[model samples]
Target chain A: MKNKVIGNTDIVSGILDEQNEFTSVYSKGQAWLNELRIAGKNAFSEQGVPKFKDEEWKYTHIAKALGEHYHLPHTYSLPANQDLSNYKLLDANTVTLVYINGIPVPELSDKLISEGVTAAPASDVENSSEFKTFLGSVADISNHNFSACNTAFLNNPCIINVKAGVQSPKTIQIIHLLGTDDNDSMCFPRTLIHTEKGAYVEVVESYYSLPNSNQNFCAAVTEIIEEENSHVDYYKYEDVSDSTILTTNTYFKLQRDSRSESFTFSLNGKLIRNDLDIKLTAENGHAELHGIYLPNGQQHFDNHTLVDHISPHCYSNELYKGVMGGSAHAVFNGKVYVRRDAQKTNAYQSNNNILLSDEAQIDTKPQLEIYADDVKCSHGATTGQLDDDALFYLRARGIGENEARNLLVTAFSGEALNEIPNETLRDVFADKIHRKLSVMSH
Target chain B: MLNIKDLRAGIEGKEILKGLNLSVGEGEVHAIMGPNGSGKSTLANVLAGRDDYEVLGGSVLFEGNDLIEMSPEDRARAGIFLAFQYPVEIPGVSNANFLKTAVNEIRKSQGLEPLDSKDFLILMKEKLALVEMDKQMTSRAVNEGFSGGEKKRNEIFQMAMLQPKLAVLDETDSGLDIDALKIVANGVNALRDGKRSFVVITHYQRLLDYIVPDFVHVLYNGQIVKSGTKELALELEEKGYDWIKNEVAV
Candidate 1:
């Protein structure tokens, strides 16, 4: 069986044999897993979510990320009184959903219900074929163990939907604050988002780790479906504990005249790998993928983006910038595929990096495969240190050599931070950059 | 106060400044005119501490200290400036921020408090106007995508802000229209003072007409072959460098 059931069977056998009575989706999940396992499907083993053995993952060793078996969050408890002031939405009129350790904390939000926005824990995602199919659809799970593992055991997810033509000027912030007690724990977080025709909204998946040495494994899968004329700007602001490992997979489908954008900023993680897939499935659909990752110390951050042009007259542009210091290593793999019949497709991608230290390393690759003749597609990758003349110029003006170099490095990273639209989120991203620079200096 | 005694330096062991000697004390603009391949650039690079060029033999005394022992940045911190023939391009670093950082670093080396953003802005505005540069240039990355004229203007702009004790303009007027040349000259002129000195090296005498130096020395092969006053530049312009080589060159 080439279907998704066998993978679910392995998942059900590992985490759900004893407690399978809570939801019907869980039962169906096991049933499908049993059927697929019986059929003995193994065609996808060769395509294991792009591995370190693959040229694309040469720098970022996902196998190391996959090797670590994380402890499941055994329990959940919202501190009787925790602070949410720092995470307040930029637009007070916007809705807010708070989740602490994979469970929704409704007490943290009061104005969301009155704003006509629905926010809840996704305990039944397996019931929605669109949701389950979207998770296993784009990602090459066989290549990525965390993605496949996440699909089998996702306990709860955040579900968000924007109705047709109802545009909210404010933003929707999905806050995932990993607690301090569960040091060395992991969780599978699935988020489903849908925008109907002519709908417009912005979603910020903001993560923070309460102070602790916990090696947190957050395998989150986000699926975004945009109807005709719909627009969705999905911003992912990841700030997990520096000692933790994070793997997040996201897929977006853009219909005719629809627009989808995915922007992410990675900070404070032991190892963070993100897979972003955007498919322009209808004529005139557009997608933009932009992100900035500033890694310090021995942290490892990787971003793999795939923009698939499936129809004619579609457009996609991707630019990912990185500033790596200390002995930290960053990896970027951007792939653009212009399908056979996707004529008149416009796709451009570029990855540029600034290595702030001799010890710092970065591996960036841009791949463009176009079968369509009437298409314009281009890609380029560059990595280097600050220019000597610029450094001397600053020094000649009386600036210390190190300070001048730092200023130049910080400025080089500003182009990517500007992509995050929310002011609060932008500030957070900038603050992380500033903090990274400060740490790199020492 | 600068003294170069029998200085000789070169790249890849081919000796350029063979026993070159020069002396300048506070408040002097000395021009060094030369044909191609003279040790004029070698002298400047030795004093400025460019590591790629080797100092085969030299005793460069800055005020009193042995200048040869210092690193290039230390030499700069000690108040030596070399306006490069070809300025480097740095993307993503603003000119204003770069200058402010340089000014503060030099000041700190001299045991002074760092300049605040407000004071730095005030200083940058005035120096930018001196080099005929707009405020926008100050916000742009240093020499990134700048024309030759703008790069030269930025060089002078940096000189004005740093107020170096000794400024070495190494072929600063090589690629400029008359207007940009005049602007660069004005920037240098405005920075001239009793406590400051300049070593203006050029291939043409037109720049000397604008800066009007106190001395003009002709460098040939690897040594200064002729020495004269401001009139010598006019003579070099009218008689041409070949005449000097065939007539008085040593």
Candidate 2:
């Protein structure tokens, strides 16, 4: 069968069986993790997978894509000759952390030596108490089915910590490569980032799939917490093969006077859904969410974001742009919330899209829920085709039609791409986008 | 040289240019003077191969190539340029980047090597002087927030940079003041090299005073009704277009 379904109850039943098998193999010296895993499993069982009837998942039907039998494992061996230098960001000082099939291989990681900074796989610190305090604290697994499922099947979670008053000079690059060897496999990759007071850091997370690999499904969750007075810039770039399905959820928590900026660049993928939620829990916090997704062919990309202002005097801004071509489809749902006690909150959200073909489409919704009387909030969304006048303007200047389209698209995505804090990483993303556009034109 | 014979074109099934005829020789500047709705802009847009206008009948020949059969970019590559009546605004695309891409594409089509960054910047700088354009404008998004005069100057700046064989200026001086008009006229005049032709379209004789066209044509109701020397522009200016309409009606 192309898409084998196990029904809702059967899926949760399978998870319970996998949890028992995992407990027998991985619960050695990690009873606390097993307890957390049990809690996550119970949550997933209670809330099964989201179907088309769900309000938040109305546009995207995830059940069909997840209908195939999937294998959940802690680790898998990668090809010895896996070359990743092709994906490295040029001219950026990066401490590369490479993961093969949800497990981190220390041999493939760069030896990091910065003061008050800790970067390693979660499996290495199974005995640390900090893991229990930070793992399920940030991400809301109770309400999110994908997050709960990911937490229940956590393998080798990549955890990054920056101590108070410390600033990392190099960006920590996390590269996850999925290789299934034709098994129609599945993996869950977990990550947690905790920055103490007055700390600063930049992280780049990228996901890729090996060529000729089996059809795979990845359920990943990354939780990030910024303590008081901390600053963080997080960038996620997704460039996977056409045969894989990726559902990733990231949560960010900002304390008083802290800042958080995150940008997601979805270049190419098949059935990708990204969920990003940020919570400003203290006063004087700042958060910026920016993303650009350029999809072609039958690729489907969905981005859902929530910015919750839980405290007073917080600021948040979001901008997302999409360029859909061929028969591709995209969905963007952005929601901003200003709590009743969050007075003087400022939140702004905008999502813009350009559809290149008659069949290509996008659905964008920007929402604002404000309860505080003293707060200022605004949201807007626009979907349109490329401006015909602008296209002719470029073509009349001796530029070919295809090149003109590429230029306009590259420029369309530039608004969000240029906001990347690091110039080197920004150029890296820009270059990838340019390459993608050229390929699309051909 | 450019030639248009019995060119009939329109948009939305409504004929705009019924049966127009015009010709421009090498090293000559031809000014197309007409009143509002006289198909002046239509003629210019048709020459640039704009797809919106359906050429019902007639042919446009430029340097032995059928301009009617070519795409807009091909017409441009074949040294045909149309300075728009209203330049379009493109956000996020820098003027410099747009110009560079246009220049390189044209050069590549002609089997010429694309200019390197340093050489391209030097060429842009030289052309900026021709239009008195601020160097900073090149780094800004293309006409994103440019004033009317600035947009007009930018068109001429691009014309100067591209240096097309036949440049069609469509109402290039409509909203400009005296000072801005002078700069625009000077910019166009500086590019008038031997063998380069221009078809300047305007409703008034104000712009022709600076460039001083060799031949003047008055277009009325989709066709050229009168053709003469530069003095004809002053005559139309003194007598207004009512006389031309009356003459054409007869």
Candidate 3:
């Protein structure tokens, strides 16, 4: 397919030229993997970089945000004894995989000691048949430019495999620290998780930048395959500095009777875009997509999600809420599709936003397309400010203006936060939101 | 404790209160009665510093401090409470949490230490019982899903928690059954101390039957046309506000 050249094609050409050098030096000896990389490169070259003319990229201009100068990752190292305490969301007992500039640091990571589960960097498991079968199968690279770009530069991707009937005892944490002080750097971090039949696993992926780091861009991709009767909970937390430009594409493939729940929290960033796609292929599949994004101070955050129900007796529910302040801009586009074969499917989607300042803006659209006659689908979007009567009511009770505003904002946000299943992790996210709201209010 | 001289107020450039005047000493309960659009609620709102009502030309002194100059929150911190005719429903904020924040903020303004959780819960329990409110009500969001009577009772419950110096009931009896009205009046009666004053603004005289007022003022055309004892309430109730309006016209 011929790709249309749009605004700012310099970034696309630069990335294409860089991919040529990247593949030659990092190509694995495996023929299938090399072929996959070549396919990804060709797909990216065809798609080029998403511009404002693209419907999917209308609200988020990726090429313009990337600018013309950026160096793809070559060699990166973390300083010795780096303080990561602020970045760790869970305790030390949980299995944690740390990645710096898209490369895993095995020495600092915990080995998966649980039975029927294997967690390792892709390089360590590249020869395994399971890794070869599932790496590029779940996520669609031909249609999504960022996913294709991520695939083109995929090197040492994280891989986690869980056998059938295995319920992991602890939550798996994947922490990606992307930044450098030398020059503007860009890295593609890839992840693949496959759970066999009747398996249950929880994964939390969080992104952060090194302290005082220079400009950095991170394009990440994560694909999860839930086999029959399996359940998976996926959470992504993005709290990078203002100098970082991050984009993530997360895809989930659920089989018969499989359940998946995913939460994306875009708390802080300069410019961030998230694409979440879920495909319910077999019967009796369930998926819930929930997210909370708080963008302030000239930041731009865009969330685009799609849930496709293909078989019968499937259900998908999505709720994404945002609180925008300063001159921030946010976009939420949620689409749910129920195919002809997806009889008795139930799909519900809602996106609500609160703009704190006059300059803040939110564009929310909830789209539902159902080809099945016997299905229940609903979609709604609301963008509003804080309730004046509620604020006055609080102040009338003697609460100060700032405290009252915070109270109302927190209440508005708690509707989404309460959906988190884990109590401790919910509290952590709530605290982060509260602290960010306090700063935003001031 | 409260004084208003030539208080003129309005909303959206439409004058509602035209040179209204009234005064009440400490420990007194003054009932201000008038028909609709007579600036009865406007007076109540102006006293509580509601920003929607513009105090065009008004001088209100509470404890000898300029009341109009203070913000609504400061007015609240300084011991003024208005029981809204239609209480705002705030979802997701538990009644107990909202009251706790209010109590602490008022205490902070008074230069006193905030009550600890244990003491605050104990206080809440006491106030809940005083207002005849169920203990479960505190766990729910403020005024959310609450019945009309329960909302009024919640207002009195908040009043009990804050224990303000002056309570302004802005048509608190607007929507309530006899049972709920009695419960609310009982709550207000329980809070009455010798030093606390009350401005019970009501269009109906039925509420005065439960808690007798020391003075009854008939407001007409934004001004008090007549002042008398509790008997004036019964007189107005029997004849309605027509006679008072006629007397003012004459």
Candidate 4:
């Protein structure tokens, strides 16, 4: 039997038709911004929504998941006295910027009090030259359809700036909440972080749908530019409702001697896609990308990462792991490229997965392209079920079957979770993993 | 405390234990010596509830309960332990954490509160001394990168922690030096408090010299063809199992 496939035109036209109306309400009277939006819209229209025909989207049928119609979020308002305590992470040393439906809610967020740091909504700094110079420079909208779509409908984009030789006192957290009031709604959240030379900062972006929310779509794009000798840690935490479809594109451009580490944790969602791209443009630059995804119960999660070594003496490493159950499907595609000039480049990539049910599926690919003869590059991928010997070993020691499975899964995920630097965040992610695994075991 | 009558078991479709009978009372150590391919390890595994072994026809009674009807964890909670011949290596799980979870799970099954961290650590220290294990060893991954001797010692250390009523040693002395063997035997002897019973399955009589058993049984072609006191072990050591094959031929 042939499946009823949703055409790419139907998905693209639905969003393209809203461009004129969206610009009328959200435009800030900036000519450059309008040009950028128009460029983004044109790029999106030319490419359309990726379909099975697209080589990169061969395994993911995203267009079929998108219905014929979706309401674009125009107004933002939270319920009166809505308690947001459950969505907060790291209370003491964190500067939170809360967003409800892509609109910043300053009253619900913590102010940025650290010296030499500027964290605010884009509207507050629209006229600044730094915002214009670094906004669309890092992310490649011409190639990424989701990034282009997000840029076209961007609303109140968050901006964070760190000056030269300054170390931020606290971690910056961006929290986006999709409320339950709007069904079939979509929101585009954007963030730009630019760090000057010798700067050190940590940023975390988390996506969550309000409790009981359903059928919401979130497209988020974040661009980070690290100057020479800068150090940055970026984390993306996604735990939305089971009916939410999330697509995120994060780009990092590192200069000489700059180092960056990124962690993506995808715990719950209907269909999620994460695209992480890192470009080491100068010598002595390093990048580390790590991710852990646990998708169960018909959920779909895909992670695609690319590390480009453009200069000599650069290093890149990537490790991604997934635990799938209940007919869920997960995909991992990681690529490392070393140019001819990158003589001393060192790149390593690995992807591992465990399927808890017979119906569960995983597709993993690790690719490396090295032109430099002196470079050290290695890539490997593995997919299998939990070791029966390990399970029986635990059960033989009196651990219940459910608990035994939990321990082994926890151990499997701990390899990625241990990469988090903050202790509190590590514990929080550990708890989330434990809770999700317990639910899947049943 | 334990009884197996007419036990017939095998793996994958081939019968190993044709019909075996054995009974052990409390505080008794019974050593079973056999030639290669004998059913000594099969009996030990079947007793510990290893699912791979198919018990074609058998009845295992531990304090009047049908041992075969219970799950491995249930059997463990019901006071049964098996010191594996080749202990499985599990990475990313600390030895101490594994023991803590096992002890607490057993306690939970017996309607007892879980031990707190301080008390658990103290208990761990006490058990570590029984096998002469270093404190740092417990902090490492469970048996990962451990030597043969250390792995064997770890099994005995876990047995001490769980304190099961019936312990099945499956070739525990297969790969151990004399010094490590003596330490392991000493650890086992310390637990002999006239209550717990042990079934030691081995290929050689060297291990029995340290932890002297009260009864010696010869397992040949899946049956206990010979049974006697500790002298039987010495006789097998001196005359070899060929003598037993000759006797059974008659």
Per-prediction TM-score, please?
0.85, 0.97, 0.97, 0.97
Model 2 lDDT per residue over B34-116, tens place: 99998998888888878888999998899878999999999999999899999999999999999999999999999999999
lDDT of 3 by residue, A1-442 (tens): 3345444667777877888888787785434567678878888887888888888888887787778867785656777688777778988457898999889998888887888887788667646655778889977888888788888887788988899999988789998999888567888888998999999988999999877778889989999999999999999999999999999999999999999999999999999999999999999999999999999988999999999999999999898999999999999999898999999999999999999999999988888898999998889999999998898889999999989999999999898888888778889998998899998942
Off by over 4 Å in 3: A1-7, A29-32
Task: Summarize candidate 4's per-residue lDDT along B1-20 as a digit string, tens digits.
Answer: 99989999999999999999
**Which whole-number lDDT from 0 to 100 does residue A108 have in model 4?**
90
Off by over 4 Å in 2: A1-7, A73-75, A90-92
How big is the positional error of residue A219 in model 1, measured in Å on the Cα after superposition? 1.0
lDDT digits (tens) for residues A238-282 of candidate 2: 998888888889999999999999999898878889999999999
Each model's TM-score for chain A is 0.84, 0.95, 0.97, 0.96
Q: Pick the candidate with the highest DockQ.
A: 2
lDDT of 1 by residue, A306-380 (tens): 899999999998888888888998999888999999999999898999887899888787889999999998899
> Ten consecutive residues with minimal summed lDDT in candidate 1 chain A?
A35-44
Q: Is candidate 1 or candidate 2 better by DockQ?
A: 2
Query: Candidate 3 chain B, which ten residues in sequence have the lowest lDDT sum?
Result: B42-51
Q: Which model, 1 or 4, shows the larger DockQ? A: 4
DockQ of each: 0.44, 0.90, 0.87, 0.80
Measured over the true interface residues after superposition, the C-alpha RMSD of each candidate is 2.5, 0.6, 0.6, 0.8
Error of 1 at A436 (Å): 0.9
Can you tell me which runs of candidate 4 are displaced by over 4 Å? A1-7, A29-31
User: Residues B3-116, candidate 1, lDDT per residue (tens digit)?
Assistant: 988888899988888888888878988899988887777877777776668988878899898999976767788888989888888776677767776787788888999999
